[model samples]
Every structure is written in structure tokens, then in C-alpha cells.
Target: MKSKTKRLFLLLLSVIFVFNFNSIKGTAGKSVTKTVRVGYYQNEVFQEGASDKAVKSGYAYEYYRKLSEYTGWNYEYIYGDFVTVYNMLLNGDVDLVAGLAYTESRSHLISYPDKPQGTEQYSIVKHQGDDTITTNPTTLKGKSIGVLDSAIKVALENFLKEKNIAANVVTFSDYDALLEAFDKREVDTLAGESDGIYDRSHAETLYPFGETDYFICTSKDRPDLLKELNEAQSQLFLEYPDYISVLRNKYYPESLASRAFTSSEKEWLTSHESVAVGYLNNYLPYSDTTKDGKVTGLIKELVPYLFKQLGYETVAIEYVGFDTYDELVKAMDDEEIELAFPVGGGLFFSEEDGMFISKPVISTLTDLIYSTNYYDNSKQIFAVNESNKLQYYYIANHFPDATIEYYPSIDACLKAVLKGEATYTTLNGLRTASMLKKPDYEKLSFRQLGYADDMCFGVKIGNEGLLKLIDRGLSRAGTEYVNNLGSVYSDDMYKYTFKDVLRENFIGAFIVFLIILAILILLLLYSVRINRKRIREKEDAKREIEAVNQEKFVFLNKMNNYMREPINNIVSLIRISENMNDLTNIKNNLAKMGSFSKELTTILNNILNISSFESGQVKIDDSLSLYNFFGKRVLIVEDTLPNQTITSDIMKKAGMEVQIANDGLDAYEKVKAAPSGYFDAVLINVDDRNIQGYLFIKKIRDMENDIRSEVPVIAITADESESGKEKIIKSGMNGFITKPYDVKAILDKLSGIIL
Candidate 1:
């Protein structure tokens, strides 16, 4: 009886122990779940609606939701107007407030992240054809400008004061009211964000100024959260450098669809019974596959329609759905699908893998999307797509300090960022833009990073024929299709119709038309005046030519005297040689005759050089180290005793080490045999009988040693005409010295070229 009782007691204790263990495990699971409190305002870019009970919608909201999934944190959103939300954050009722622009006043109350969620620039928007209205602050003086009663309005007032412009600023309670005032002509200009006011065909966006960084605000008590948030935000930006641009395009959809298919592509499409197209299973705006297996999205609706228009009456589009972009790429690579729509640039596809890509079906910007609290953080964890080399390289180059965490998909990376597990993620601008417009992702905010590469379709390497066909179809779609598609996806689909254009700009257009007509008449009168002036100038130029010709003739006569004396001397010497009986006497006479002949040749060569120089046939290779060369050594080549003495003296006086060569042949031999760079500059007299100056220069230029060939050469000549200068330059000589050398001028030219 005693043993039975002990067994029952022991069993009871064991059962109690098991129950406590199970209870503790359940409690611990609940404790692990964290609740994050978010303060939201009803702003279109931040929070879309005023619903307090429903899921918060906006860029910030959606971003945090994804973050919650990443971090295993639950978000409790508190909704209010801008002021209410801001106060809640300061009061610690909310952990953080979304989409707050950083200001000195705000900074004193709450701590901000290191990097902004995005940037906002103020734009002066005016109706199309309002040419009189300009972006200049001075021009805006005395004009009525409409602005919303937000931080931007304060910025505008400050700007006006700083610029000293006296403008009548009209304040509106909301962006819609501001735009309404602009539309009704109540205000001449509307100042707002570009994404809010930019229109391709209707409103002209101008004068972007007062760029303010938007951030998430957190109480001083939650510095840790702010620090974490900042790290994550910075990492996101590093990965997706153009996330902000994507946001702008998403809200605006400014890119037009203009690709048209070629005839061959259309023919190929018609021949094929069906085409297999891969699309994302859940990528919104770009592509989406439903539970019923129906594919629909911007790419889905437009791609099929584009095919139908390309002569394929019943071209069947067999849709293949993939959970991630990677899967889509794999499907294309495996030839399971001929093409994949709404894919990234060639960076995502490898050429080695044999992929043929089409032109972008939709083009948009890329952006950095992050929480506002972590605006300036750098040492943060970044979530990036593992396969995206573009993002990988960009991040590696720009954000070296940030830790990188790879995800299979962009969405997954973004989720990591949202959860605070990773600091930030980058994405295509249009994709971010589309996400912002949706209620699910309304809380996320982005800053324009840069223009993203256009999104295109990808095909397997072997599908070149089909790829061309798809590209051809894209080419046929044209700009209208793109504009229409943008309108469908954009926040405002209203385009400027002919009637609207006329109604808005009739007076402006009429004034412009009258001004243009007047300008044309003025231009015509100016042309007539210019033509009359040109005729008179031409007549005057002809008279000037006659005077110049007379002067040249006189100059030539003076030069002829130099030739005549040399020729006469040579003839006298030859006649003397004929009378000589002894061999020594005969040789002496021949030598004298040769000297005279050489003198004549030198005069003739000088004249020829002058003519060539004047004709603009000479090109000077001015690239020479004159100071280093001339300071060391200079070679003076001249057969004439008087000229040689003058040349050597001038070179010595200029601080150049002189090496005298009696004639051109001697100079050439010295230059050819000397070590490279031995001579700094060579002074040649082309009149030498053995080798002409031109031949010497040409030989030096063609030498095996580059240093010797490149040495500066200056011609010493009696010809003072422009033609003489031309000839020296044409012969590859750097410059010319007249019969009477000017020491200062020669030194100056040398100094100028060398130094």
C-alpha cells in the first residue's frame, strides 16, 4: 500500500513539471514578438488617407510593414494630421513619426537619422505657353505665386527674402488647393514638388529650389531605434542608388512607350502559333499573376496588345508565372519561356549565358528607399539582391563601410531593410513609384537617386529571331501608347487636349505669334543691311590686294640683286679657272667658283622658303624643350664666315652653349653621329652647297634616335619677307632669324617654346 502511494506522488510531480515547461515555452514565444509604434500623417507621399483603424497606407507605412516582417515586429500605427502626428512622436505616444523634413526647430525636440528618407525640391509650375513667366527669383517679383501651407511654404518665404524678391505669395491649405488656384489663374505660378506638378504636355515645370531632406523623427529617449533606423536607411540607399527617381516615375509615370516592331518581327510573330512569356507572380504595376492564372499588369496588358497590333490577329500569349525575377531569368535561360517581361537591364543578365534583350518596354529612375529616421547613417547593414551585379558594384564602390546582406529578391531585401535587420535596399525608380501609389506600400518614402536603365524583356540566347520580333513590336507601339499607359498608371491621367491648350494659352500664344512675326521682319531687315555691308567690304578688300601686290614686287626686286651678284661672281671665278695652267691654281679657282654658286643657291632657297611660309604650307612642331636644350648646347651651321660669326655670338650671348658646323653636310654628320639629345637647337643656313637646309631638317626628322630628330631647328636667312618665315616653319625649322639677328627676339622665341 505504501509503495503504490509513493508511485502516484512521483507521477503527479512529473506531470506538474511537464505542464510548467510547456507554459513557459508559450510565454517565451509571446515575449519575443516586438510591437513598434508608428506615428503617421495624412500626406499623399507618406500616408494616403485619414483612416485611423485600417492598415496605414503610404510609402512609410508599407515600408514599416515589410520591416515588421523582417524584424518579427508588429506595427501599431497612430494616424492624425501632420501636427497631431508630430506631437504624438514628441510625447512618446509613438516611437517614430514618418516623413518629417529636418529643421533646426525640429532637431531641438527630436533626434533624426543620419540620412534622409528622400529629398524634396520645390518647383515653380506654370501653364504651358507662359513664356513670359520665368524661374528667376527676380522675374517672379510682383507675380502671385501659390504654395501649400507646409514646410515648403516657409522655405519659399525664406528664399524670397534671401533673394530680395518682392512677390505676392498666396498660401493654400493643401496641394490640391494650390494647384486649383494655379489652374484658375488665381495665381500665376504654383510652387510644389516636381512629382506633384510636372506635366509633359500641359504644365511647364521650372525653377526647382529649396531642396529639403525628409526624415523620420524619433523621441530623444529612443536614440537606439534612431541609430538602427539610420543605419538601415543608408544601406538601402547605397544598394539602390536611384530609389528616389523610381518614386517620382511611379507617382508620375513620365516615360513614354515609343518602341515599334520591325516588319520582319511582325512577320515572325504572325508565323508563330503562340509565344511563351514569363512574368512575375506578384510584382505589382509591372506584372502580376492571379490565382486563376490570368496574368495582368502594365507589361501584361500592353505586351499582348502590342503583339495583336503587329499583324498577328490571334497570337496566343502563353503566360508563365515565376515567384522571383531569378526564377523568370532561369525560365528564359532554360527555354521554358521564350521571353520574360519587365526585367532589369543587361547587368542582371550575363552575355556568357546567351541572352538577347529587347529595348526597355518601360523606362524610369532608380531610387534609395529608406525610413526617414535614418537619413544620414553610413555604418548600416544594407540589403541587396545577390544576383544584381550593378547594385553590388555600386554599393561596393560607394558604401565600403556598410555591411552587405544578400537576399534572393528585391522584395526580400527590402523586407530586411523594413524590419531593421538591414539598413536599406535599392530598387528601380518606376517600381518604387508604383509601390508608393498603392495603399499597401503608402508609408514607404524614397529619394530620387538617378535615372534607372529602362526595363526590358529578356530571351534565351538561341531566341534571336523571336527577340528581334519582340523588339520590332516594341518599336511599333510608339509614343502614344507610352503616354496613354503612363496616364493609366499615374496619379493624374489628365493630358492637355487641344481645347484645353487653346483655352489656357490663347492670349499668350497670340502675343507670342505677334512677337515672332515682328522678330522675323527685323531679321529680314538685318539680313539686307548685312548683305550691303558685305558687298562694300569685298570691294575694299580687292583694292587692298592691289596695294599688297605692288609692295611684294618691290621686295622681290631687292632680293633679285642678291642673286645677281652671286651669279656674276661665280661666272668670273669659272672664267679665271679656265685660264689657269697649273693643277693647284685650277683647283683654287674651282673652289672660289663653288663658293659663289653656293651663295646664289642659299639666296634662292631663302626666297623659296619665304614663298612657302606665306602660302600657309608650313606647320611648326612647337613642342620642344628649348630652355633645357638651348641652355646646354646649340649647333650653328653656316658656310659663310661673316654669318657664322654673328650666329655663334648671338647664341653665346643668349646663354646657349654653341657648337659650330661650317656647312649643312658637316652639321648633318655631327648631329647624326652625336649621342641623342647632344644638341639643344640647330641653326641652319639653307644656302650650303653640300646639303640644303630642307634636306638637313628632313634627315634629322627621319633619324632613328627620337631625341635627335625632335631637336629644335631655327633657320638663319637674309630673306625678311613673310614667305621666308613660312619656308623655315615648313622645312620643320621652329623659327627664323633675319640677316641681322635680334638677340632679345631669338631668346624670347626660345623661352616661349621651351618653357
Candidate 2:
């Protein structure tokens, strides 16, 4: 009986243990969604619209949403000013806060994850046009800098102390106030975090410094939450390694320089006394070798500029020119050329001829150049440069049935099209513009192919250190600098003088002059004989002839001025296109040429109305209203809803995309968000009740982004006084229109300015 009882007791204990184990497992399997309080403030991309419950969207906000997928955490956001929200997290009123850069002082009050979200760089900013100060710290020694009363102020103070530079640091309550003080000229400069959310459109970063990692912080009391958050973040990132980068790209279109050359890269640079770069000699406007063996192209200018950014001068570089890309590649393999320049980013380099590509220097769209007699061919034949695998593959994939003929270079490919040996050839659209300047290529018409290529520098595979240094230099130089370089080179190429026009047109103008002179001499001889026939009648007739002669001279002078003005403009454009070698500018000049041709036609039409000279003078009617604004986009800034509708309707009727902004502030934001050339024109309501339209336009004009900053603007107002008109012009507006939108007037003004 005793043995049976002991066995029963053991079985009971085992049953209880198994039941307990199953219950614990069930509890662990079920996910318990935890509610965490998150605190934030109104900072641009990091945390925007945080104060509003309806619209909470930003990088940090997106991060939390993504994190919830892993942690099953529900968040309740608490918003306040930056300091208030930070205090809330410290006091445990909120469990979490994001966008805090890790600092030793703050670490005591908060616990952070093992990995940071991203980085922020504090920088000094100035008016975009200000060149008084540079990246050199010495230039800022005595300048008064405006800074926010936040981490940015801390960074500025630290930077000042580190550089041993004494400058007055004025603090403001917030970013808006800080920028306001900067605009008022209360400070010589401004310092703030350099990020996408910052309004860089009107401000330029003088120099970036104090780069540090920012993290999502948890209250010290919530150590458990911190651990859970850390594990979830780790697993999340492990699954999608590019999660952070994807968020950044989605929220921030502009990138900041965050790279410094390592010791090895610097060593590589020092060891190389001179670097030889090979380029195709026929790639005009990009890189080309002159008859005298002098390199004169954008790539030639760019290489020196990039090197200068890395503290080296142009003397350290040598350019080697090749007629064919194959030759350039051969030079690279033989170590005769250390680098190949202006290489297409999509280019393929085989393992045997290994090469590394640097960051893109510039990107341009492609163009299809074809003979005017393309229809004469029964089958489409594409002429491709033998070394351009990108073009060859692109044509093969897009036109499977088409035949591709290989050529030695872009020049040869184009010539094939001109000779009718091929139906078409593709080249960089910008480069193609320079080619068309040749009179023979004029027989070939071209259009954009909706394709683009990034031009980069190529280095041998073994010289990765050099490639990294080049990439660092490119990053430091920045996109804005590269774009400016492109503009400068393009302008240089297209340069022309009044002397060129005079030389080209001298023969034609002289021939017309001789014909007019002969006609005048014959008329004088005929009048003299008529004068001698009658005496008193001769005197009256002579006086009458003199009056007619005076009228004729007046008419001729007026006609000459009107006709010659447009002719001079047309000739100037042609010469400029030849010199500039820029395709975009060529298109713009071509439009201008069309306008000039229309003006000439108007003058001719007026001449046909000779009967209008019955009043002893000729009257010319130069009014034209054949405006075709189809497919154009315009921004209409109007406060009143009805006015917005009316103006929008008018623009829409003309087949334009009419974007409306309720106020000047809204208009400024819209303009800031848009890409360059996105809007063909902007129409501002100058008498806006909220912000003055004149001030808004001035802000746009001061924008650092050249695309929208240089966009044409017209003001809408009730005031039609001469002073009001003068004010609009002085405010940097292209033109103005009185209130109560006139469709014809709007179309005409836009056509003249944009079209």
C-alpha cells in the first residue's frame, strides 16, 4: 500500500508540472501590444506637423510606424516645443523621444539604442549669394552668428572653441526666429542643422561641422522598453538593411556631405605625384582635344575643379586624348592612363580590364539624331559607337527587329546617319547640340529620347583608394558646385560677340545697300529733269517732292530700325549657339529665333499696308495673339477662392496645369518643393492679405536653387498706377497684371515670357 501511494504522488506532481509549463508557453506565444508614449516637436523632416493630431508625418514618425510592425507597439504622440518635449521624456511623462543626437550630458537622463537612426551636421549658413565668407574658419572669426537655443547652439559654441575663433553667437527661441533675425541682417551669419527640412533654397551652407549620430531615446525609468526597442530595431534592420536609407531618400531629396578621406586614401593621393586621365577626343562639349593638342572641354575643367576641392591644383593632372574608346580602355590596362574620364555610369568594364567608377560628375538626357530622309529607309538601322555597350544593348532591347551598325566614335555614328547608312544614332543630348552647329549636321534633326546617363570617372580596379578619394572630393565639391561648373563651361562654349555678327552679315548688308543707292540715284536724275521743265510750277513741285522725300526717309529709317533689330537678334542667336555648344541653350535660342522670325513677318505685313502712309507717314501694327500654351504648367497664387477658380479656369482653357496657392506663404512652399523648370511660370497675387506678393517674389528670386529662383514671375494686383507698376519691376518680378484676370492679357504675357 505504501509503494502504490508513493507512485500516485509522483504522477500527481508530474501532471501539475506539465500543466504549468503549457500555460507559460501559451502566454509567451500570444503577442501583447504595448502602448508607448512618444514625445516630439516641430522640426522639419525629422518631426513635422507633430503638434497636430490629424497630420503627424515625418522621418521619425515613419520610423515609429515601421518599428511597430516588429514590436507590436502602439504609440500615443505628445507634442510641445523642443525643450518641453525633451523635458517630458526626461520626466518619464513620455516613454520615448526621437531625433536626439547622442551626447554625454544627455546620456545620464536617457537610455539609447545600440544603433543610431542617422546623423546630423551643424553648419553655418549665409545668403546664397554671399561669398564674403568661405569654408575656412578664419573668415568667420569676427562674424556675428545667429543660432537657435538648441543643440545647434551647442554645436556652434563647441566649433568656435575648437577652432579658437572668437565670434558672437546670438541665440533665438526657434529656427523660424533665427532665420528671421538672419533675414533682418541682425546677424552676419546663421548656424543650424544641415538637413533636408532646413530651408536651404534661400540660404547656402558656408561649411558643415559637428557631425554626430542621432538616436531614438527612452526614459531612464523604461529600461525594459529600451531593451525591447533595441532588439526590435536590430532585427528590423537585419531584415531590411536599407530601411534607414529608404526613409532618408523618401523624406530628404537633398543630400549632405558626410565623408572624409581615410588615412589610406590620403596616402594614395600623396604617393601619386601626377595622374593621367584618358578621354575620347571627339566627345565635344564633354571632353575634346584641340588641333594644338590642348584639352578644352567640360570634363577638362571639371577634373581640375574636383582636385582643387581636395586641396590640389591643376598641375597635378595630365589629360591623354584618344580618338576611340577602345584606345582609352587599352591605355588604362597598360597603366599608361591612371583614369578614364567622362565615362558613362552604365558602361561595362570586363574583369580582364577591371575598372572602378567614381560618383557621377553630371547627368544628361540622351537624344536621337536621325537624317531628315529617315522615311526613305525600309528598315530601321541604328548607328552605335562600338565601345558603347549601353547604347548597343538599349537599342537591341528596345528595337529587337532593328539592325545596329557599329562605328568607331560618336562622330562616326552621326556621319553614318548623315550618309543614310543608318536611320538614326543616339548621343548625349547636350553634346548633340554642339554637333548640330556644324552646317552639315543641320540636315539631321534630333529629339530627346527620354533616357539619361551619369558621367563619372573610372579608375583601375587595383586603385580603389584613389577611387574613394575621388568620390570624397566629389562629395565635398557638392552637386550645386558641379551644376555651376556645367553652366560656366556651357556659357564659355556658346560665347559670341557683336563683331562676329558684323563679319558674317557684312556682305549681305552691303549688297542691299548698293541696290538702294542705285535706286536713289536714278530717282534723283528723273526729278532734276522734271524740275527744269517748269519754273514757278517747278518751285511748288520741288517743295512737294522735298516733303515726299522727307516722308520717304522717315519711313525708311523706321522700317530699317524695326527690321534690323530682329535680324540682329537672330544672327546673334545662331552665333551664340555655335560658340556655346549647349543643347538646352540651343533649344532656348531656337525658340527665341522663332519669336524673332514672327516679328520680322509682322514688319513685312505692315509694309504690305502701304496705303496707311496716306497720312504722310507709315503706321506699323505689331500686335500678335496667336499664343499656344498647350502642355505648359503655371502656378496661380490667389487668396480668394473665387479668384483662384477664375484664374485656374482661364489657364486650364489654354491647356495649362494650373496649381493654386491660397496665400503667399503657400506659394513659397509650393515653389520650394517643386523641381527646377517644373513650373514654366508663376503668377503672384501682389495684394495678398497675408503676405505681400512683392515680398514673396523677392524670396523666390533669392532662392539658392537656380531652377525655380530664375523662374519668370508676374504679379496680380488691383493697383494699376505707374508707381505700382514700377514697384513690381523693382521687386524683381518679370511683369504684372491688374486684378480680374484677363485671359488674352495673361496668355500674351506668358507667351512672351515663357514660350
Candidate 3:
């Protein structure tokens, strides 16, 4: 009896202990806060800054803050340069990193979530004044470019290589330095994120190369953390479908919401009760109406959301099932339908047809489809829809001998080709892809035959208001939405010819073989002409160096001669003045000295001006109008006594109302105190030490009054190089004049620019 009581007591103790342990474990799980460590670098719209204050306010920081709210996680921020932060994540020093773009190399080191956090486009940026650089990659040969030492550098290098362009690529440590180098003319072009460049008013995007998906990456070992982050992100997106757009607009407002509703447009929307929309019955992926009369597809989903956002609460969508697109147009003309979607091309509609078309919702490649075994040398029948005038014109012009057969629909055309009723059919690549999925169309193949067709929406004539509304809605519907819709239906249907296959797969090998053969031929040629070529090259280089040295020597000798005359005259005048006791004689000698000094200044100025013009540093502004601005009033800021007199005399002779300031400080005060338009232009000597030319100009540019701030300022400098001009222009100067002012040249420049 004692042993049984002892065993029962022990069993009860064990059961109670197990129950308490489980309860404690559950409580611990609930109380513990998971720490999420994030690594990031400074970017304009992404990380923003490395400082704790700025990092906390950045897009990535805000994103993580929202994520923490969803996941109940605490964040620890780690900041460094991009490469260093990337390394930290790789080494597991950080649990996750924000604003990382996925690459094949990066994929091996870290894991990205299934859905990207956002997208950014990469662009080639150039000075707004630059017009010589073409958008074509082939034109980039031998051009200099600035890029960050990150993924952008790799992308730029790859692009250059692919185009066979041997460009000079300069890499910077960060985006700020890269832009600085470009602004300073160290590099003619820059490659980076579009938002950074587009934000600058002085810079413009030449072309966009590609887009990258931004992700919050995790260390390879932290897959569970990555999964949790993704879940939190998905929840946020689900709860707020416009979260990404809102973030983008907050950071890059200039790139989004470019259009605003006018008062009239607002009034129209307020007065309207509902909008009538129409769609076809068989336009897959874009729009489709079911047999039961239910409408669906991308247009149906996008149009309603857009209308709602535009402040319309109700919409009436109708499906118009016609035997042919022509019949559908006839129905619209008769006012049976207000608007129709998935219209093929603009060529089908005209003012005469009483229809207005919106901009393209999507672009599709046109392809020619035929059976694999079918071939005929004689005149062949081309199957097409009569409503598709663009395709009809293309076929009739390209195949003059072929006969055309009109079909009611794309489906009928494809069937006609398959059943040998027509020799071939031309259809959109996207539609062909959707049709080829069926087993019956397995034998049909396609080849791209024409330019891309733009699919849009058509409205009845005189319905301009409805057209405008549709356009506004389409503009608000971002590129990602349209691209997603396009990707669902479009497929690669192009059948490569034998030549294309060879070029794509083995061109490198073929080029190598050709190079080897050429080398052998060159060797044979060299054996016969090597001696002559070597002697000629050496002699030519020797002659070239000699010519350059001789030219410099002649220029220096001429300059010395010019200076000697002025010095001799001044010395003679001084000696004469020393002997003269009469006041008139003394005044005469002083006048001669002044004349010599002026002549000497003119000689030096001419030399510098010639050099500047020859080096292409001084760009003449042909748009200046002397009668308008500069001819009326001008301010001259010069610290040097000699420069002040020379510039004032030149401007005065040019018929300008010249106002002189002894220094930058004096100029700033005078300009600030003056009324609007008191001075049409300003010419400041950048070499002045007091108040500093750049600082003074910046202050003037930041003035509260628009007219006073916008007064064109020209830089006067002795440094006649491109860098000098660039520095002046970047300091907010409208133009620059190299030292040694010519009255006629100065007047001409002012006249061209002042208007």
C-alpha cells in the first residue's frame, strides 16, 4: 500500500510539471520580439542617406517600419557604402538588406522575395544643352561615360560590348560623385537610376535602357526571416493595393500624376451619372464577354478601377458581339454603343468613319501564319479581316501578285488558312499564341512580317469628352499594369531562318575564324610592304611634333614683340614726364602712358580670346537681343581696377547702361537693393576674391523676386578652357566671356543673348 501511494504521487508531480513547462514555452514565444537587422546604402529614392536621422526617414526605412507593424519585429539599421553593405549581408552580419536589385551573381549570395518591393528604370543622362549624343548605342562609340561602381557599371559595360562600341567608361564611388563629374564635363554622359537624373532640372534623359526590380534581400541562412518578410509585405499589399504607387509618388512625384483635372473636367465628372463602356466577345487577355453575357479580362478590370479613381461611382459595360469588326464600327456609328475596347489599329478609324480613337492600350507584333507543309510559287490567297486596313495595305503592297480573301474574324481567318481555303493568314503574335495552345493548330507556324500594331479604344464621332476621359484614365494606369496585361497573352512566335540561327549561335566563332584568315593575309602583305610603312610612320610622327613646336615658338615670339612696343612707349613717356615742368606737357605724357597701357591690355586680351574660341570654350548665344535686355542696362562686378575699367569701357561703347561694382559683396548689395529689371544682365568677374563670384551668383539666383533672380549673369575669366566655362555655367551664369574684351565681340554676344 505504501509503494502504490509513492508511485501515484510521482505521476501526478510529473504531469503537473509537463503542463507548466508547455504553458511557459507558449508565453515566452508571445513575449519575445524578433530583431530584424537591415543593411542599406544612400540613394535618392531608396536609402536616401547613411546618417541615422536621414536613414530613419528614407523610403526603405519607412517600408521596414510598415513591415514591423505587420510582423511585430524590431529593426536594427546598418548603414555603409553599397559594396560594403552588400558584403555585410553576404557575411551574415545583417539579417536583411533593403534597396537591393537582383542579379545572377547576387542571387547566389542572398535570397529575394517572390514579389519585388518596387521597380526602377535605368537611363543615360546628359546635359540639357547636349544635342550631339544620339540615343542609338552605336553612336556611343568612343564616348566617355560616368557610372557608379555597382550593378549599373556592369550593365553599361555589357551594353557597350553588345553593341561593339568601344566607349571610355569612368566609374565613381557613389551617385553624387558621378553626377558631379558629369556636370563638370569630366564625362559627357552618365548612366544611373532615372529618378536621380530626372530630378535635376539641368539634366535630361537621353534614353532608358532597362528596368530593375528592387527587393529586400536576406542572408542565405535566414530563409525563415525572408519568408516572414515576404508574408508581411504581401499582407500590406493586399490591405493597400495602391501602396507601391503611393510610395513612388511620395519619392518621385514628378514622374507620376503628370496630368491634373481641369475645372471643366471636374464639373463634367460631377454632372455625369454613369459612363457607358463596350467590349468585344472574343478579345482574350484584353477583353472578353462570356456566353452568359458576363464581361472579363484586363480592360474590364482596369477601366472600372480607373473610372472609380476619376470620381465616377457607376459604369455600364455592354458587350457588342458582331460578325465582323466593320459591323461593330457600324453599330458605334449608329449610336448603338458609346465606346468599344480592343480595337486593333488607328488605321481602321478616321474622321470620315465618325470615330475617335484613344492612345494604344498595348502594342502587338504582326506575324504571318501558315501550315508547315504548305508552299506555293504561284499567286497565293492571303486571308485577312476587311476591317484591318493596316494589315490589308501591308499585304497588298508587299505581295502584289497575291489575292486577298476577306474573313469575319481572326478565328475564321486562322481556320481558313488551316483548311487550305486561304494560302496564309496574318494575325497578331499574341492572338496566334493564344490560338496555338489548342492541338488543332499544332502544324501552324508564324514569322514576324510587319511593324507592331497599336491596339486602342474607339468612341463615336463628336464624343470628344469621353475620349479625353479615357485618355486620362489610361495615363493614370501605370506602365506596370499595362505590361503585366501584355505579358499574359504575348509569346515568342518568331521562327528563325537558318541564317538567323547561325548568326545568333556561332557568330563569335565565325568572327574569330575570319580574324585568323585576315591575320595570315596581313602577314603576307606585310612581308612585301613592312619596310616602307615603318619608315613612313616614323617620319610622319617626327614631322608632326616639329610642326607643333614651331607653331608654339612663333606664337610666343609674336606675343613678345607685341608687349615690347607698349613697354617702350610707356618708358619713353615716363622719361619725358620727368623733364616736363609745364602742366600741359605733364598731362600729355600721362595721356600717352594711358594709351600704351590700354593697347597692351588689348593685345593680351586678344591672345586669350583667340585661344578660347579655338578651343571651343566660348559658345556664342545667337538668341540674345541687344534691343530687348542687355542693350538697356548691365551690371559689371570686378574687383581688379584694370578689369573693371576695361569691361566698363567695352560695355559703354556697346551702348549698354553700365553699372560697376568694386567687389562681389558690393555687387550683391547693389543687385539686391535694385528694383526689378533695373539691370537686364550682370557680368561678374569669377576671379574676384571678395564675396566670391560663385557665391554672389548663387545668392542672386535664389532671390525671392522672379525677375530679379532670373537676370542673366555672364562670367568674365582669364581661364580660357572648357573647365572654366563649365564652372561658370554650373554657378548659375547664363554665359561666359574669356578675358581681353573686344568691344565688337562683347556687343555681339550681348545682343544675341539679352533678349
TM-score of each: 0.32, 0.46, 0.34
Instruction: List runs of model 3 lying over 4 Å from the truth.
Output: 1-31, 53-55, 256-755
lDDT of 1 by residue, 343-363 (tens): 654543446435677877776
Candidate 2, residues 1-755: lDDT per residue as tens digits? 99999999999999999999999998997889999998867777777786655587889888988889988898888878777888899899999888887778888889989989887777777664566877788889888998877677788888889999999889876555676788777888887777732544456566786788889899999988999889989998899999888888777655433333455676887788788888876565667777798887777777787778766674378889987666777889899998887664354533434677787877777787888876455778999988655467456645679888998776688889988899988877556666676655768988787656677888877887788777867866778877766665553343322221233354365446446644654554454444345434667577766665554455545756776787788778777877876666766776676667656654443343321232323322234325667778999987754355556756775778889988777888898899888889988877754656877887888887477899899888778999889988999999988754444566778888998
Candidate 1: give its CA RMSD in angstroms.
36.7
Ranking by lDDT: 2, 3, 1
Clashes of each: 57, 5, 6
Q: In angstroms, how far off is 688's CA in candidate 1?
A: 99
Where in model 2 is the C-alpha error above 4 Å?
1-87, 92-96, 99-243, 248-258, 313-315, 345-347, 350-353, 376-378, 385-402, 407-412, 437-443, 487-520, 524-546, 553-755
Candidate ordering by TM-score (highest first)? 2, 3, 1
Distance from true location, Cα of 132 in model 2, Å: 37
Residue 469 displacement in candidate 2 (angstroms)? 1.2
